[model samples]
Target: MGHKLRLLWAAYRKIVYVYLLLVLLPACALLYVYFHKASAELERQVAESMLRAVEQVRINVDYRLSIVLEVSDSLILNELLYDNLAEPASGYRFDQVMEQRNLASLIKSLKGHDILGIKLYVPDDKLYAREHVHFFGLSEARAQPWYGDVMARSGAAYWVSTRPQLYGAAGEVQALSLARLIRDPQRFERVIGIMEILVPETNYAPILSGAEFADDAEAMYILDRAGRIVSHSGASRIGERLLPQPQFAEMTSGRSGILRFAHRGEPYLAIYDTLQQNGWKTVSFVPARAISRPDWATSFASPLVLILSFLLLFILAAFLVFAYVTDGMVARLRQITSRLRLRGAETVGERIANRRGVILRLEQSVAHMLTTHEQLVADHYETRMKEREAQLRALQAQINPHFLYNALDTINWMALTRGASDISRMLNTLAQYFRLTLSKGRDLVTVEDELNLARAYLDIQQHRFDNFTFELELDPAVRECRIPKLTVQPLVENAVLHGIQRKEGHTGRLLVHAYASGAGYAIRVRDDGAGMPAEQAERLTSGLQGAPGPAPAGYGLYNVMERLRIYTHGRCRMQLDSAPDVGTTVTIFVDRLPER
Candidate 1:
């Protein structure tokens, strides 16, 4: 593994090198290999097809030669002919003369129509060499170039690639012929005469023409067992031996198959097969370039190479730009991280950002922490405010749990000490007062109803105190909001009992009003009667509990303040303003969002 890493770095140390090493290079190599393999495969297939084509021609050529062999076979078995032709004729007689001359004509008239010439050669004095007439004596037969191999073939015939010009027909480029020895039938080992059959080499041309391969640039040829070129695309190379070439070495090694070899510095594909019956072989040869990458292939590949090169360069450039940008970003991130550590941001962002692999998410974490801190602080202050309001609520408490029993005990003691008549009178007054204030035990009343109560009380008091006048003003919009039943009535009663009733003359004026304040409502009790100074009014409105002075005078003002503080959760306030010869206004203000 260590070695592999080192090798990788060595090969791909730079971005461009890495791209070339891993991507472009492999692709180019694969393309090059694929092109060659595809060409080779195509050539192999075409070569096999051409092999089949040549094999077919070999078959037809063999079939045509079989006809001559048949005629030769019949005459070779004739004992009477062998007996007469074995010895030179003593004199020309009608029987011997006709037999010798008619022998050539008889073989020529055989069933095979493609057979163009047939020659008979016998060692007899009566015959002279007349090659055109197809009758040759011993001198003509012994003078032929292929006379040795033909004589050596005992029973089987020898196929000649080219016949001597003396024995060829007119206009023949190459004459394919068969030469055979006529052995005495009884003593078949003794040679008596020779028979040669001739035909134009073009007899096999149709086989190649019908195939789908080139007949000009590429070639197919046949070689006999003697390694003689029996048939070729052109006849000039008929007698040449291609079997000795290094290219044909592998072809001769096996009965059939294909091989690749170089010719004239160019590669070629050759497929070969042997004629099983005759030991002859046919080879089909094709240039490798013709099958693999043709002329059009090179033309098309030029543009493709340019496009691939451009794409490779573009990719390399993109990688370089990315590296440069990310490097700068990493440096900036390191600086930010260093600053954050020194400033002590709780490093919560670092943990979160590290998990997600992003620095911006670190900022999100910091923001989240700040928001959480703010929320905690708000909650802390809210709790303290709630505690303060709870203390105020305690001040709003009225009767204690043991007050009723304690009061009954005090009444029993009072009955013992005072007269029964005095105790009975006090009980009756308290009972009537409680019944009027309870109002069937309901705790809440609309401002309109409460104002009506204040007006009714003032109506009764007006007869007792003829010196006072009272006015009631209530906003219809504020009348729908409910408050404690006695909230506005007591304030009005304080104005009447203390301020308006105590005034010296009939100049005392009382105003009881309620109006909208924010989302809640406000009630004001103003009296234009004789009012006290600010210090005296503050003394009266100071407080009911924890007082260093005497008990508070205005129970009505004290009760309203306590109720507003408790019910509104310290959201409401009551202020009393009074000056010498000036009116005193008591206002109970509420905010929109009530604690309840």
Candidate 2:
């Protein structure tokens, strides 16, 4: 057992070495080069896509902000509010009411589904809402920081950033506000009040969280100059400050590009663009995994899995190509080895050294050696074919057909001269037998001639032995069909010699029948005599003997089968049905019309 295991291990090691050298090493090197090149190209594409996505989001934010500016412009341009609000202490009570109505109407016209509310704080210390104006002290308005900020940036818009607009003690909502210092249209310089639009953070969520970038984007937000998130995809981060802000020095540096950073141990790519309208930055955060992902197949597979799959396919394809070539060489080598043995020679090494040795030197060299061995085997095969043909001609020369015909004719004349009826009939049958068997040396003959040959042969056999009787039932439709000569005669001969002659104490009967069955013709020879056992019957059809080496008998049957197979190219089939003490029936079926 140990010796066998060691031999197995040695063979396994040899095969593994060859496999690694021929298949695995080359495949791995190619795969490595391809994977790196593909990964680099894929990363560039992903970065470009992310940049485009971020640019698109920035464009959308700018467009929405322009709409807000348009609304602010519409308010300042209205003559009714400008006339009444610019003169703070005019005290025209009816005009103030009319101006309040006009301001309410303007806010109603500009407000959309995404708008929360609008506020107009007049320098008169009065806040004009939808219905009326609420008076407040001028000192209170001047003390507010946002009020002072709006005053400082007169004639321009300012972002108050994101903050929670508290409605009640228990209710609060995230809102993004834009405040503008409303000025008198006549002076174009005198500030009247601060006009602010408070909008829900949800209004800009669609622009920030564009569906096209959903696969990779983690977040999108508009950041104020102070690095505070004014508008974010999720309302929860609307008022949050970006901690550890990246490229803070470059944020207002008037440059726009992508930035790579890690957050909470997770890597991310930040694509940002500065908005000239508000001095704010629009940023889109994309996860590193998403940026590194290639396509559907590679994206779904882990990096390890993708590398392993590439290796597996590479090795499998290389091995398949190698094995296919190796199998062809191995088959040719086996054929050569078989031929050498038949010629009473061993392998190439044995022939050269007069001793046994392994035919293959190394796995890598085996294919080349086999190819050269095949060339030698081809020459040997040609010589053997010529010798076999010569042997066949010599065997044919020993059977002189003309001399045998003449002898049969002489015997017939003698039997007739002696007035011996039985002898004359038997001699005539023998002459017909020899004539049909020869058939002018033609291998194929009409079915009628074949049947006649069987009939004559059987007649001679029955005449020579009176223990058996025979009957012939042939279909006329198939009698003209061509068949191999002496096809039916051999079966009849077997029935007489092996079947009937073996029976005892009773007379035997032989039946020879030929008929059309479906698209083919069946020729059957049956004998009611001593039948063979199941094993012998099986061996008769299968051509397998109980032991190795040559069969002791049954050469005629096997030869007939081989000839039929070659003549029909395997289209014809033969079957044997028999049981002990019953009878034996041999049926030959030819499936196609005979050629010529």
Candidate 3:
């Protein structure tokens, strides 16, 4: 037996060592390399894609600005506009009508676009074609920052950061200003007036909102030279200053390129391009984690752990097999030897002389050993059953006695002051509640009995608190379903004590509802009162059972959950939903068993 056990142990150790070296080690190394390479490749792809998105946004903004510039060119060439401004006072009624018609026609051409309304600001006089023109004092037009900038530029177009509004026939609308100095036709250097285009920011949203580098990326922005957001895809970001990030210093420095930054403990990749027309930067920010592909290194960790656990278990099982086989053989051989020696077979030579007779006797010993093993297994099972039953009984006896005292005390006072009928009714309800709690020493009881237990408890509490009320809605189909006793009463007590009793002036309402759902039954208790915090509700489901309790809320809940899980073998579930000052709902779900 010793030699055979040694051989078996050696074989198992050799196999385990060989498998660890040849299989697990190499597989882990390969997975690590694959994840590293894949992560690098994914970062490269995302960076390149962000650069492309930045360029596309730049083009879209430039295109929108160019449209305004084109409109400026058309106005500069309009002979009626120049003639009307050059001369002021000498015109008839028909000439005035024609000039107004020409100005209206010019405004009509740019309609249905982002141009909210156009105003030609002239400081010369209120007399010269104020038909579509806004006449202002010369000092006033030159005093404004935007208008002064346009005047300083001579004829160059400027995209103003100040969002101005344009009032039209329809209504007033917000717009971004694109202002330019209108030049005299003959003397190109002479600035006559300013032609300002009010373009709505909505025009840029359609193009930029569709341009996304990654799902987690911040929306793209058109930032002005001062780093203020002139336009952006997300409405919330407009008018906000873009933070001067180190990653996109090129944007703030008037250069164009991409850069990476790790800011606020998060990895960021940013790309930017300068728009030549307006000196605005088209910038996009992409979070590094958003674009990273799933890595095999992370995904393979669970499987590797499972495999290691399985390997350890296999080694343990192999050792157990060796120990059991060798030990059992040695013990059996000793027993047979002792019995044979008592029959006067002491030497190996004497035993071998009657080997056929010895073999017949060995068979009888094997049969008796098998019978003994069966009996021991049966005894262990019975012992475990008795232990569980004792635990259940202990849990059942632990229901709050204060509630019983209160009910009896209320009955005694009511009997003396009120009538015999009232005394009888309250006593009957108390009897039913205790009967359901005991359930004749059985743990399982019908759903109807459970609901009645809750009803009795609530009725007794209602007499104590005048502001308290309750409703029960039980499905007829699930009335006969068997669930553990005291399930519904504890939850109802929690509702009454913590939920309704705390509210000062308002009447509190409690609801007990049960229904069939899927292949199971669900019992729900709800209350309108000052509810529990979310974390407390979460703890009731996850951490409550193991916590040391004789606690106010935890007394019955822990026991009920433990016994329910044991009886159902972990098929049932409990959930809690709550918000402060709103309400609380506790739901218990149990799988349906075969009909009794």
Candidate 4:
């Protein structure tokens, strides 16, 4: 009996040793995976936090600039400024002097606001006046780009470049200037000068230089428009350009939202927004390191400490269990452990092969389920999308038909009012145009049909105007291409109604061109009429969602964009490029439809 007990004791030791090693291997593997995953999760959280910080900066800067620009608008519309300018002989031959005086008074009214100084530039007289005229007196304003641009735009507000200049009582040299043309409200003619506001460095510097994430993290300044580093909180390289240039230009052009950049050897995430009021782009950059520091430290320390504690507790429990078990049972367990080791080696390969087979079958089953589910989802979505499209079409139909009917009725009334046979003929043509626009039951029509409809609309408009010429250039290849019905006509109507109708001295030229683009067809309607500003074009493109309200008197650009989005499932695109005197181009891109 003593010999058997001794044999069991030896057997038990072997069993415990093998069992502990087997459990330890898997525990170690699990620990590795847990830590790796934790690190990855920490990185993602950090990146997101950095993004949020930058966005906050963008919001704050844009908000401040918008307020300043609103103030500038009020100054332009102010009766006092107008009254002062109207009295031309009050020792102010140039309106710039009066603007500077009035701007100074306006700045004082906003007592605690961050306005550093006010200045004015008169291009025709080549004169400029700031608050501290003793230092920068009557400079050649024509040579400055700000003055040139203001003259070129006639009456538009713009944020000028940042350059060092002296102003105010202290005569401190600093980055300064915001300029806008002063124009007569009645005729919209330029009234002698451009108003310039000097922005205080303190107002902008604090935005660039605040505690962002932690002690180690810093914020940097880049050109609000181009993302070029104008200043950095750290490092001497302020003017040097950042690499992988952040999409600052695109943001300024109003294309995208978040941007990332590496400035001063530190990675930064940037959030940017365009200021509609002043045309200035504001961006906030925050270091990526700041966001991840807490998470990274916690991820490393907590996991290692948890795994060690768990290992110690598990080892103690395992030893106690082995101690309590009988010696004879321990011998059996040793044999079992030896068999398990052999089985485990084989099981690894077997499990891998079996897992592959199981995974293959699982994947096939999942694929079949997904296919059925996707088809069902697609059908449901397609049905809903179609219903929405139909509702939009119904709404659009109500508007277009009403507009055409009113236009025709007006033409008929005009013919009777004039008692002219020519007017009667014009009314007949106009009626036919309206009839074509109200096509029997078709939403998608041939490009040829659209062109014919547009020509008819133009014919009526030309007759009404007595002096409008239109040219049509159609590519024969695109004649069979299908397009949303009434697309071309509305664009042409916009041109005639908004562009040419209001201008008195010049004859308007309307050009319609159709051409082939990559994998699609493009149709452009162009007009040499009073073109819209960039801001107006941006609003028209972006403001398509929600309720359709009263449109501007002449152009229904938004309506056209909405109709295109609905019909083409966003495949079709419309682009409008315009300048005040350079005229406007409205281009439409549509996929070439398969032959019916």
Give the worst 10-residue stretch by lDDT in candidate 1: 352-361
lDDT of each residue in 439-550, candidate 3, tens digit only: 7556788888889889989987876776878899999989998888778888988888887776566568999999997798899999987787877777776654576354
Per-residue lDDT value at 51 in model 2: 58
How does candidate 2 score on lDDT? Answer: 0.67
> How well does candidate 4 score on lDDT at residue 471?
87
**TM-score of every model versus the real structure:** 0.45, 0.46, 0.45, 0.45
lDDT of 1 by residue, 1-596 (tens): 78965764564469657666777777777667755564455555555555555555555555555555556655554444465676656566675667665665565556266666677787656544444466778667888877998877775778776543444435444677778887764466777778777766677655544542553442777777656676776666777876556555567788888787787788776767776446777676667666544433543365457657666777767655555555597876788889888988866556422121122322343464466456556655654455444433333332222343356557756775776855554444443333334444345556676777676667656755667788889887786676766677677766776666566764688888888888787888899866787777777666533232343336656766666655566677777888766667888787643333
**Model 1, global lDDT:** 0.63
> What Cα-based lDDT does every candidate model obtain?
0.63, 0.67, 0.69, 0.62
Error of 4 at 313 (Å): 3.5
lDDT top scorer? 3
Error of 2 at 280 (Å): 2.6
Q: Which parts of model 1 are misplaced by more than 4 Å?
A: 1-22, 78-92, 127-132, 167-173, 187-190, 209-218, 225-228, 243-249, 295-596
**Which pairs in model 2 have colliding backbones?**
none
Best by TM-score: 2
